[model samples]
Target chain A: MSAPESILKAENLVKKYREFTLDHVSLNIPKGYIIGLIGPNGAGKSTTIKILMNIVKPNSGDVKIFGLDYKKHEKEIKNRIGYVGEVQYFYENKSVTWTGKFVSQYYKKWDENRFTALLNDFQISRTKKVRELSKGMRVKLAMAIALSHDAELIILDEPTSGLDPVVRREVLDILMDVTRDENKSVIISSHITEDITRIADYITFMINGKIHLTIEKDDLLSNWKKIHFKKGALNQEISQTLSNVKEGMFGSSGITDNYLKIKDKLSAAIEKEDIKVENVGLDDILISFVKGE
Target chain B: MIGIMKKNITFFIQYIGFLYPLMVLYWFLRKDSFDLPAIMISGFFFYLLISGSVNILESYEFKNNVYHFFKTLPLNAGDIVRAKFYNVLIAVFFLFTANSVIYSIIIPDKNMQVFSYIFILCCMLLTLNIIAVLYIGFFSIGFNKMGKLLWITLILWLVLTILSVEMYLIKLDANLLYAFISRINRMVWVIVTFAGFASYYGLMRIAIRQLEQNYDNV
Candidate 1:
């Protein structure tokens, strides 16, 4: 692959837990781009993000944010980068006003107006202690703090994992607003690929602790077209020839490859018989990827 | 460094402000005395010097369900440890302040030299504060064991205090208080403590780094 104009890059990151190993994973988020790190549970998405944020250290890997090594430029990198995880720990005893002030002291570019605007938008009371807020409200508070910092690069790990649809939409709307800056970028992870497809410029599909594919969101949507055919129309040879395929029979029919190779093979099949090829969504691509077809 | 130090101090002061009052009522007498509040507050302040630091590390656990949140924050292990220490010191010192202020008010012209006694107590507690932050942050003991750090520290301090008192009661010199503290030899202790603290902070940093490297949930 050519050298990407990446703002955030993780090179050959390795980490291990009791049963799962985060294999040597390398990914890139280009400058001025929003990317989705998409993966199912136990897929090491959060681990990889943690490594990038310098919350978790990789055994041996390089994480660079804005072209600076994470370890060498920790203070500088952290001051500029904002992160909102699925579950953030706020001091249960402290009110939002107190914690906001506390966070502002750590960040040089904290914007009180932006924070208050987000808070007001969410209808969150600044006087309420964190412990009293519901899970959704807690997530809102976390997001508010993350966005208030005026960070150029915001890394969100599973930001919409458990929120209701309305809250999720609200988050997406705010992210949409953030992208208007042109210089600012976001790297977000979610099981919900639709959200990723909506906002992401680039997308990486992770499975079993490894990144299966890293494709541009626009390229993926435009280029990957699912080919449908009769059950006996395609053979093992065609499936083997295609690099990417979704092999399964539905209602006495077969759906196969999404890549261009499928088109070449299916054209040959269509000459023999009438067959239908259809457009594929991000969900279909992810399903095929997870199924390793 | 000072900013970090001030944050920690504020944390510790607020801790004792609420916690020690709860402890004072734990042993309310059946009949009230002329200076009931004063005695119990002073006693609890003394209890805090040693017992307070032990509780400092556990407060992190008490404060959050998942500590990995703290791990992922921009803070390093050194900051976490120092914050806990400063948090405890500030809380305990202010608690002691409350006790002394009320004690002097309740018993004016009292010549017990309570303020000097509190100074000695504060020094002992500071050592406990440092030691607690180092050990708990460095080790991966479960929360149960983590909670025991304060209890263990309190027990150790109690055992030493009993022995020191036994020596004084048998030989009864007012200078024995100074003698006990001098035996600790704060200046030499400070020099030796540099190595201990370096090792402690170093070990905690390594442990936190290890915890970071392995992406274990919770």
Candidate 2:
């Protein structure tokens, strides 16, 4: 869209497995912004990230990182990307310093001073073996390595999955700091909507390997509403207008992005006090969509 | 390339220790003045044991999900396979030299023919190592398949060796077997050695292409 001022653009990415298929997934990650790829487990979030990283190939599609063809300029594009996957896979017997030294050799602009500073900031011991470190510490180490490489775009897949809240906040803050410079950007995929809302500028919600919505965070929040209707009022016409609906003993509640249109269609019900509308948070919106509520 | 080699060496350090028993066995066998065939058979098994550590290294990487880590880096499939090839060659060279030195020290009466024989054995083992890396990396064969392949190959070699030995004793007589072994001259040895190295790089190129094509599966 609009000629892709985006640092990362994936078009028509398709990958098939026995149980899952990432069906024609496409998304543009704009430059100088954080776009959260949000979805539930098994929603193809990791698959999409893998395709972007070239860890897995798409059956048919094109991915361009930094506007360079992913296949043709993979080495150059990867050099500019700092990525941390959902699982940590450092040599378990090696020290943190060894892992850092091993990884830093691949990056042209690896900054040892910055790496040391980040290690100090994160309180990770450089001499400690990777196997001796906890999962949270390993994540911090990964983040520190990713940041010290002068990467222009950071792609994190569930980087905060197992961390304590304190460390999670620290990681998010570090990501926010990365985006402070207008030239840097981030694309984080997570099931935790709150984490995305805390740091993301835009949101892309995915379900069953298909993208459900891609909108600005503020726009999504401003437009989507969870409307409740009295029992016997949720007829076929009203149901057709809502994206997801759940009926209970007392009434029916549903979500709709076209709040104004839904309100106009049910003006009679509104005046008669049969329906009420309330704003939905990012968490509620995602859960409603995921649960088909 | 040097960085990847360093990583592999470090990872394989624990495995190289297992070769000490083979060295000790070499000493005991030499004390009894074992025949050339017995020594060569022992050498083959020792080579197999040493190179088996490479399989261990691979299993650890696969178990820990380390393949994707390297795939995500600024390294192409050829670069990755080249690193592995070089690393394994270096390791094999080290182990081969160590085993040869043990054989030489324990069996002090051996002539120049022993050195030539060792050289041929080293080249042959190196060729097998290169071929193994190509097939395993290109096809994404896991440890189970590799273990099975190794077992089947070893069993087949054992059967062939027994059959050859039986034919030598029974049909052709021992003189015919000795004549065949004697016909291997320096020129032929040099040619075989050169061919071994040539085939190694040839397989390396093919493995790189296969790796690039099937990188996603890897």
Candidate 3:
């Protein structure tokens, strides 16, 4: 696709705690697309999102949402963004309708009709107390509330974790539909790669509080490849060129970003060493990067 | 801020307000005899107990990890702090009014001073609110520390505040302030009331700053 508008940009964002630190993180989120933030536990995915929301003040760095500084224009920026967390928080005894009523007043352009429609679609009872709703239902309820406001961006942290496959798919489908509007964007972080793989347009991989890579999903999928070689056929020179290379008793295996060029250079070696090449998926890419680290 | 107020009120009314206050009132009413001095001391302790316990109850709600939820809504740390401050302010006002009225009826002796009781109530509320501000402000830096330390500190602070306010109310020139309650000029009373309001606003500002700096911890 042609160049799209940049909806979010974070430059060298940093937050430190005794247990962990988010070191010099930056990413650009374009309008009208989904950017999947994928990482293992304690990878700072949640921290990045929190900084964007201005919920957690970063030790240093800048965050711009919709071209405005997040700090200076917090209320304006938050007003136009919808956010959902892995585990929702609400007064357990309060009814869903009370939550809606309480939350709707905060947004300027809240759509009552859209909220009602979403609740109906999600099959959630507005009269039911928050504690009565199942985990999946609570997530759906949060989604409904987020979508009801005419937000330009939706940021969800682990929206599909611990959820059943059917519910996960339903949530993903809803997210996919959300980006249909050209002015809208989404940033969803999840460890479940398949949930993001089906919907993400861009992928940003973070590990150990650092961003490993940020690239378009299509480009990543097209460029990165996995290769296998027969035992004792690989040398240090050839293995150094690949990523996450591992040598086993039976064979050698690795993944590479420069697949085409590497394939051309290793052609002679591939034929001689009986190497097998294959396209890699997000799961493989994540595991390779993590294991490599 | 209004949203936060509504949230806190809804939670309180639905969960604790319905039963807890009635119990406290029952305990207050079942007394065998109505001695003015005993009533004053007991009333102050009972109010402190209620306020402190409710504060603890709300802390449990925060433990449910609702700060993230508040962040998602269109509110900032200052707004949240303001909401909480006002909610507590309103509750304290209601308690003061209710207790003053009930005590006035119980001790129908014209010699018994009502303003002293009201004055003590205001002091107690202000002290408690300031403690809350200090607690929330210090809570962020102590994120890694054990909660027991925080609780112990809070309880200690509560005891200190209760003692200080009690001394200020009943022991500062006892004859002039408490015994000869009518002798205290109108201007002095106005000044004290103004001072109370001023202190509340000042503490609220501090609490707001504390919350802004530590919104993530909540």
Candidates' C-alpha lDDT:
0.67, 0.77, 0.77
lDDT of 3 at A120: 95
**The candidate that achieves the highest TM-score relative to the unseen native structure:** 2
Q: Count the backbone clashes (under 3 Å) in each candidate.
A: 8, 2, 0
Q: Which stretches of model 1 miss by more than 4 angstroms?
A: A1-4, A235-239, A242-265, A271-273, B1-8, B15-50, B53-57, B60-74, B88-126, B129-143, B163-218
Writing each residue's lDDT as its tens digit, candidate 3 over A1-293 gives 77888999999999999999999999899888889999999999999998988888999999999998855677889899999887888767779998899888889999989999999999999999999999999999999988999999999999999999999999999988888887889999999988888999889999999999988888887789888889877767679888888888899998889876766678866574488878888889988879878
Q: Which stretches of candidate 3 lie over 4 Å from their true place?
A: A1-3, A229-240, A246-252, A263-275, B10-35, B49-53, B99-111, B114-179
lDDT of 1 at A143: 82
Per-residue CA lDDT of candidate 2, range B32-136, in tens?
654444545555555555456666777677666666778767887777878877776666666666656666665554453364355436545654654455355
Q: Choose 1 or 3, whichever is better by DockQ.
A: 3
Model 1's CAPRI class is acceptable
Question: Which window of 10 residues has the lowest lDDT sum in candidate 1 chain B?
Answer: B29-38
A14-132 per-residue lDDT for model 1 (tens digits): 98777988899998777788889898888899989888887767777788888988656666787778788878887777798977876776677889999999999988999999889
Per-model DockQ against the true two-chain complex? 0.33, 0.59, 0.58
* Tens-digit per-residue lDDT, A1-293, candidate 2: 37537788899999999999999999898888889999989999999998998888789999988889865787899899988889877878789998889888889999999999999999999999999999889889989988998999999999999889998999999889888988888999999888998999899999999999899887777678888889887778878878778889999988888776666677854555888888887888888777872
